[model samples]
Target chain A: MNKYIKLMSFLLLIIVTLTGFGLYKAQASSPYPELKVVTTDGKPEYIEPFHFLGFVSDTQNYSNSSTIVFKDGHSRYMEDQTFLERIDFNYNPQLNDFITDHRSFMRGKSRRTEHYTETEQHVIYTGMESDVYWNQPSRGLMTIAVLNKETEEEETFSVSLGSDGSYYEVSATYVNYPNLTILAATNHSTDISEQFVYTFDVENPTEELTETINLTQEIDSNGGVYFGQSFDRTERFIPIQSVRQTDDSEFDYTEEIIGYFAFDTQMQELIDVPLFEEDTLLFADNDKLYVGKDLGDTIELHEMNADDQNLDLVGSIEMATPTIGREEGTHYNNLFNQNITLLDGRLYAYETQYSDDISRPLFQITDIKTQETLFNGTIEPKDMAKHDSTNIDVFEFRLDTLNN
Target chain B: MKKSLHNFLKFTNFELERLSKFLFALMGITFIANLVGYIYTPMKYMGKINEYIAQNSATSEQAIQQYGPFSFYNALNSFWIVGPIALGISGFIFYSFFIWYREWFGKNTFAYRLLMLPIHRMTLFYSKLVVVFIGIFTLISTQMISLFIGYPIVSAIIENTYYVNQSLMEAVQLHPLFLYLFPLDLGFFLTINAVGLVVLLVLFTAILMERSYAVKGIVLGIIYAVVALTLVLLPLFLPDLLNNHYILYGSELIIIEAILLVIVAVLSLFTSRHLINKKITV
Candidate 1:
């Protein structure tokens, strides 16, 4: 031992220092202080089962971000010491599907919800494959993969887009057992884009039928079109919106919704939906479509009329425009797209409301039918001192249905 | 089996002793540089902020708003922070070659005595590999200590008002390069180190090839390294090469990669053992 003193001492130093550091880090548990959603008013049980997960980014250095989870009235770090552990914390079925199944993995994470759909009998994935080089004549092909859930077999095929125009995007996909419907937006050489609904058989996908929605005839050439939220695979209708940019100047511009049409996948026709006010928020969950108008003190939600396809008054819920500290100019707000999430007839509206005086993640859940505010709260640190150390706020939220 | 195990341990300790001075010097350089970075970077920032306040007649709040809050991550960006990192990396790389070559070229051609030992020649290979692995973890441990010591000192130097407290996890998130080298996640850390170990094995095998074949051996060594690296990187290229739109899942890709790593590692070790035992003319 004396002869090997140098080796022993060096080994001891490495082991002790590393072990101590590991124990300290492990004991610390989290970098940010523990946070909890303290309900100031309304029923807390409404949001008791749901876990809101999002990232808290440093406003000063946007690059530095941490995953935060608000659940069971308390907030914790979503990302832990391991990759699999972090995945387990914010578990998404789509993400889980991607890992477990090769077909989902090939379709990619971004399109896991929109361009992919799964039924009890069949799982389907679609994407637009186009030549990336702009100078060359682009060959756009619709790539499709269908998996039979019962047999555990997958059939993959691609159909060409006729060499006329490049189909750059597949916006929405719907699975109806034997038939798989895909809504793709194509960009032509003349700077005019077109939307086409491509329907295919799951067994023989090469046999394709495409219908081009004449958007050029209905709306202005300069306007852009997009599909509303179609998260559910069984959704029958995809709400399409065409908006033209109204530019007052180089900096000031607003998009005006010129045309709102619902593309019924079963009927194979576009039904015109009456356009609401320009500022109305449009979101669709499953087959039901709703437009929300923020009226300062209350948010008025109007659902689509089942018979006429016109938006009818559903009900208005109580809500206040979130403000920062008393010093108004020292705060920032970044509301995510489709901030209002309607799940099981319950509206979950959330956004990061930040201020130097009080930074909190504010969320309010309302029962759509009863027009009653079920849960209203702000996520904050247990200790005010903890809040001062790290400027933490939730950037997004999801219901804990997937984990359950 | 007991005798071989004993010889391996003895050789590992001997190799570790041989590299102790170099490793310690690197560790000291890393500690001092990181420590200075933690202190100097923030002090410099505070000086600039004070200068700004004096020049603009602005409050500390306004200055903080403009420059942003100073955190441990700010120190990470300083040029001084990379000194130890660069030294440690280059030292290990240079030593990987020198570890084998020195046995042949050093006083009394030490390779002859080492190979002539009663124990298996592969023990020498395993021992050198172990020392390299030890030296890397030692440097990592030293860096961890530096952070533990430096974070509080920096908090004091910058003062609580200006200092933005961040967890080590948050620090790594901000600077991704640290997460790759010194991952907090045990699985990730092991995976990264496993890759490093395989890479070292390949390099050692390449060095042995040079020792065995002389002039012709240099080209063979380069080819051998290229083949090993290509096999390791095959998983990444397979999707693109086959034009199959990433048909492989994450877990499958990882499994394939792990298998390839094991294969490359085993082949390198076996080839090295054969070269050192039979082919080398010492």
Candidate 2:
């Protein structure tokens, strides 16, 4: 009995001694670390601090309807009236026609179409007028710019536009040595009958072009031409031609997809491959081209040997479950909706489900070699819409092996 | 086999009878402490709010909004509530070692009588483990029942508007420790208890090592403990030794832990049986 009492007291003593040392260490150390704050203009400032919530994916223009509240009892409401007006216009065409008739009362403006071309270093924005007014013809204008993402430095590249027709479309193809930008233009007509193709060097945009391709024969009446990069980093001019047939009535016409032809820049010939509606091109490397297709409940990733153009079967992963709270009457397609990217021999797929109840975003990483799922987890974002549709824009997907 | 089973059951019941008074006292104290916390927290909070209202002429709603409503968070954070849990865990840890030591060190020399029983000595080790297991569940059940009983008394005192009330299951989910003890998933609850059983078995083997070697037994016990812990944790670090390093999934990690626990249990029982039959001083 005495020995039992001694053991009990000794155990209590050890526990108390260890707990006291722990408390002393905790008191000696600072609870919160010092935080460094920087202003938008790269200058440091000491100011009232606020906790940083996570960033929201500003996709589908949902940010316009979002509300931001600060800890200082200040709240800001964002209401995008233009987006509401656009939805209203789509639903009621008669109302749009009535507004268009009263051009003097309404703010009527000519419509312009813009194309965005993105590379690793630069984002090129080009806009062109679609319609010509009475007695006024649209002229072609082109501008080039260099944007450094790391330094946030932007400089306008010197450019000279020819006295030609209005530029309708622009395509950019990046290669190893000299990148090229192709511009297609036509005179004041809706039909692309007599079109001119002009190529410019991306690096030295100021230099005048010594050679021009008179592609009137190459480009058919209803055909579209675009520039793209092949799997081997070779620049190819792809022309998607269409066949048009007149119906019994002179007013009606029918157009069918003939085929897509790739014009090799170096070989100066066409490369032909069978095109299917289900096979959508996802990514291309030097020797292989990755294509994705929907297989009922799962998405199968297939690799096409770009050398021989033979398609081989790859593994598949299950598609995300649908949102529970989607509107009853609304027709929502849940096919090919996930964002998938292949980087460093690994595939990353992100799927977000949004309904009237809750929003959850799931991310998965799979190794391409083993075809095994390496990681699968949910990403929790602050202020996630609990009662509405969510759009998660994945702007960048990178795997940093060094940090891991 | 029938004789062994009968002796095992008899020894387990005897251990329970010996510790019943101590176990009941521990449970009573823990329950009273937690009950006091559950009642005092809301009363103290409402007093502060009333004082604030008297000084500033603030509405009850305004006061509730500014200084948040009485919640399960308040009850969980109360020192009285936490103190009982800490005390229970500490007492149990000490009792686990004491259960084996008491037989050897007691006035009546109980170890000699226990070993002299014409039964498999492994049954004796297992009987003590079963007693400890039953004690743990009883204490947890006592704490849960105390919370259920104390919650209504608190709610009756504090007005519905002044507090955010939760259901029994919701309150259990809100508390981190209670969520594991009374898990919603049956598999998770079983997994947690299985891990606890493995830890108890390891401690039993360490205690047997001490009883076998006497003065040199303390060092041997510590060394045995370190080696057992290292073996159990090898799976977690073994991947790093390979060229193609990969992380395991959650299910795979659980499987590895289960495998290691089995290995530890087998090794512990084997070593403990050898010490009991061959090297034990009694």
Candidate 3:
């Protein structure tokens, strides 16, 4: 039995060894890894304009088949990542789309107005204005429309540009003022306050650069002053044909501002003022004084009385930054910090309240000098269609008409 | 014999680096794997030897049967353990080749032939056996030391004695014995491993003796192995063929295994003896 056992034991070892050898020959285990491509910013911005969350398909086919998403109530678009020629669409279908089957969705029926700022560049959809819509309406679909900046002949629609250069249709059609003048404001949208968009009659161009805040002013002794907005924008701001040339051009395009003025009424005067932190991004002349305070909530107006450091707690109200597009315009107020601005003897305050979809009221136009409301209404946020997640210049709008 | 043993000691005394190398490799690889495994895929990484206990940690008897620390040690000490491992199967192959070509037995080549040796045939056998056994000794002792150092090595990283204790205790629970001793159980395992070489040696002896054709000797050895396999199968496979409902418990299976090992050791030694003493003719 022992001999038999010995013999058998020998055989089993051979089997195990052969198996081990086979395994060794076969090779050990491993888990090879791979990589993915992603783009960081893709919302409406100033330089190159399109609707919010809007990118034309690929620039290769900018006129046809490319669509934009504007933020409106009860709407969202989800498509697998695909190649697009001009991917952005307008908030108002009437502007970009015609009655359904009558027009092949491929060749959308609207007159093609906005061509790509750069030919053959792929247009991506970025969701810039969607969040603003979500902030306002809280829930429910809001309509946001997009129009080629060049097609905007007059007060065409309620609009707000995205981080990407695209105009998103907002549900607001603020009582369309022929000319707007934003003197001062606080407590408003995250984007720059565009109280005015002055047109330069000569230059014809298109671009997208979203976030912008432009103003020029002077102050007096008691923090009382009148300042007019220069309906100015960069990227979309056209320099006069002569001004668009070079830095040394005859027409000075140093910092494009068509019209600006500060009335000498409620003026605060000081010999000289403390310079702000060079690093500190000054949103406006008033913003330099409004530091460390929660500006996201409300835009505060204060008195720069002599040495009264705390900007002499001059009465502060809300200010609203207005958006425009194809829809009529309006405004909204915030629940927390309000955008407070003093314009033309009136305090235009806006308190933005956010929801799943945003639809804010325009500034509460109250006269600070007389304490009366000149205009108070909700402003239009971009419809869901104008939203994009990738394109950064959503606010880049073009001018079809110039002012006298 | 004492001189032989001394020489053997001297031979292995310098082997610490090699042993340490194997142990280091074993341990380093294990530690890294354990570390990565603990971080990435803990379930696949750790304490696998203690699986029986892991699945039934709540159970008492089954837990005690595991050899957890040894498995864990084997993993971490692979760097050091690899050297000793080279002396195992590869060593056997090398030694077999040496013995085959050298005809250190019947009639090949070697300075210390049984005829030329100034000692009895058995003395030479005992000497070689001692050397081989010493190799086995170093292998097992290194394993034990590695198993011991595993805690300290792991502690360097974790700095948690309680966790170490828990892990070590679980490792211990997996296997009841602290050490697997030689010349009996362990010795049996090695001898069983050497049986194929023994059968070859026997044929080699038959070649020198010309008692049968050298090729016939190989054929006979193969036939013997097949016959033996049939006998072993009678109890395992034939029982099923007979349809008898016999069952074995844990201890009984272990005892049977032990017997089998002992049988291989005796048979291999017996064959070695015959090969050593066989008369050389051609």
Candidate number of the best lDDT: 1
Clashing pairs in 2: none
Query: What is the per-residue lDDT of model 2 for residues B107-179, given as tens digits with 9 covering 90 to 100?
Result: 7788999899878888989989987877776676666667767768777767777876444444544466764
The alpha-carbon interface RMSD of model 1 comes to: 4.5
Q: For every candidate, what share of the true interface contacts is present?
A: 0.33, 0.00, 0.00
For model 3, how does the per-residue alpha-carbon lDDT over B137-256 read when each residue is reduced to its tens digit? 444443444444554555443323112222442242223232122222233334344554344443333333332335666666566555544443344443234332223322343455
Tell how far residue A402 is off in model 3, in angstroms. Answer: 99
Task: Give TM-scores of the second chain, every candidate.
Answer: 0.94, 0.93, 0.49
| TM (chain A) per model | 0.76, 0.44, 0.22
TM-score of predicted structure 1: 0.82
lDDT of each: 0.69, 0.52, 0.31
Task: Report, to 2 decimal places, the DockQ of model 2.
Answer: 0.01
Model 3 CA deviation exceeding 4 Å by range:
A1-404, B1-89, B96-108, B159-164, B167-169, B172-214, B228-233, B247-272, B280-282
The candidate that wins on TM-score is 1
